[model samples]
Target: MINAINLNSKLEIQAEAFIRFYYEETKKSAQQYKERLSEVAAEIRETGTYTHTKQELTFGAKVAWRNSAKCIGRLFWDSLEVFDERSAKTEEEIAAALLRHIEHATNGGRIRPTLTAFAPQKPEGSDIRIWNHQLIRYAGYRTPDGVVGDPASVELTEAIQRLGWTGQGTKYDVLPLVVQIGSRKPKWFPIPGEAVMEVKFEHPDIEELAGLGLQWYAVPILSDMALNVGGVRYTAAPFNGWYMGTEIGARNLADADRYDELPAIADLLDLDRSTNTTLWKDRALLELNSAVIHSFKTNGVSIVDHHTAAEQFMRFMKREQEQGRDVNARWSWLIPPMSPAATPVWHRNDLTEREIDPDYAPQERPY
Candidate 1:
């Protein structure tokens, strides 16, 4: 419950652990660490909470990303570009900053790992929050047949529609950025069309697959999650890294609950989908993953294949090992969705998934 944390004796204990880790990582002097700890304690005694310095905010965010046990992309955790927007109070300011973040992180197709943290939550009052699961996502409309877009976004898409967002009713309609400051009514700001970057899918060899016309956004900036730095809860922090090919191909497009393009893809491939023994789904998934990887590389958008990403994750583990630090990882998540048996991480018998401080965590939905 990092998001719903209250001022209590445990607050100081958690804050101390985070600060101590920060000092050890930064190699700051012992005296400076002690003084800062004292200051933090006094501030908590007086105001029930304390503010993080700019350096603390940035470094703590990177640490949070590094501590995300479920993320296979943690190899690039230290390279996260942190944008501190803690001073934003108005919806306009927050919206403008979000737009700016998209533009900067998009980086003209070479997506960068980036995060922007807004004002932290108070002890009791309105807090800055963004309702969208991701800064960029397609709307889902529940039609008679099924969901027309990303089924994962049905609740949010319906929520926005009720809020007076009249979409074009298209399969890939970009959802508006929903922002809320405290108890005020949430506001929906339509993102400028050009700000969002997408890569259209085109198979390298299967020419007929192009006729399906699939595309996915370049950067996946998760907006609804919270970042806990020490004991301070920055509830409006959004962060993203370039996606692994399997994430889009194996899961988003192939999963039955998501876009469910497997049957369509199998039809294009002329595979024997008559029975599960034919393994048509597996063949279709391979081609789909190949197309996603090929399309992204052809368009110059940064995306890594599952195998390469796994290699990088191993490197990250080795680097942490040299420092005598345990690499907390979730085995199931670290294994690629497409070919779990093909990756080294999948063969491991032990994988620890423990909660670490200064980490990214899910918060109670504001909507």
Candidate 2:
């Protein structure tokens, strides 16, 4: 069909563009670039796709992080460890690779930025898919009282339950890893306890905050994104950077739709919650975020607070400017949920989110 021909042609064009970009960034010889481009052209002509060389894959993976407009951690983009799992086609193989990713990235408790590139989808889109939004996440159980765990996970948790997974029915019960190859049925594997590193919530100044029983999994590995390098789509590529404090505090825990801990936290702290002007939510958020940062540091985990992370993002923009690259960013994402005006990014007027190639795109859930 003409559609197939057009798809192949687009892939060829994207392939050449990425190769040129790669060579430019790496300062490899023009002859080598041309040779690689020619080989890719031939491969696409015959098979409708071309495989990325290990070097190309590595560079491309890093570039994808750099091109991620929503991420604030691009300053450390080059430090990402890429684990190539393109040959992993079975459920056990993929699950094993993901678990290994967890252990390696957890790094005893100091999390490392990592990405595990899985099998790339064909031109028409058939390859591996990870059903979980994150490799290690809390489950949700709906009851007459309410959702007992992460409310964000209610849908996935129900689907996972349908797949015969039973959690321990706790607020912090880590979910299993679910992976699917092609259109085959997905399989769930309980995440090994040894690979999971968790930081229990504790306050540096407020000792009573510990009794709330909040905890978070270390190393937030996003497993549902498709990493697009040139035209090849690694449908199940899971990647992670260490968490920023407000992400867990101001948003994940404090959000009313999420854990909604502010009310209880406010009550515990004895803040006046009778009216919005009392600023009870603001007070609670500050303590929650402080507790998160303090606890993570106490447990030897890598976590960045919003202020430093915002400054670092600006530095990243400056570095890109020095390299004659236009910086693209999303204003909403760059501004931390806790204190927007306190960060440099929130005051910026020119933040625009323009997406580029070799990026990680959010894919629809295969479940």
Candidate 2 lDDT over residue span 74-142, tens digit each: 999999999998888789999999999999999988888899988898866668889999999999899
Q: What value does the lDDT take at residue 128 in candidate 2? A: 89
For residues 1-367, write the lDDT of model 1, one tens digit per residue.
0121233567777777777778878888777778887788778888888888889999999988888988999988889999999998899999999999999999998998999999998887678999999999999999998889899999999988888898887778999999998889999999999999998999999888889989899989999999998889999999999999999999988899999999999998888888999999999999999999999999999999989898999999999899898888888889999888888778774979887787889998888
Cα deviation of 314, candidate 1, in Å:
0.8
**Which whole-number lDDT from 0 to 100 does residue 131 have in model 2?**
92
In candidate 2, list every pair of residues with a backbone clash.
none
lDDT of each: 0.89, 0.89
Error of 2 at 145 (Å): 0.6
Question: How far in Å is the alpha carbon of 337 misplaced in model 2?
Answer: 0.3
Which portions of model 1 show Cα errors greater than 4 Å? 1-8
TM-score, one value per model = 0.96, 0.97
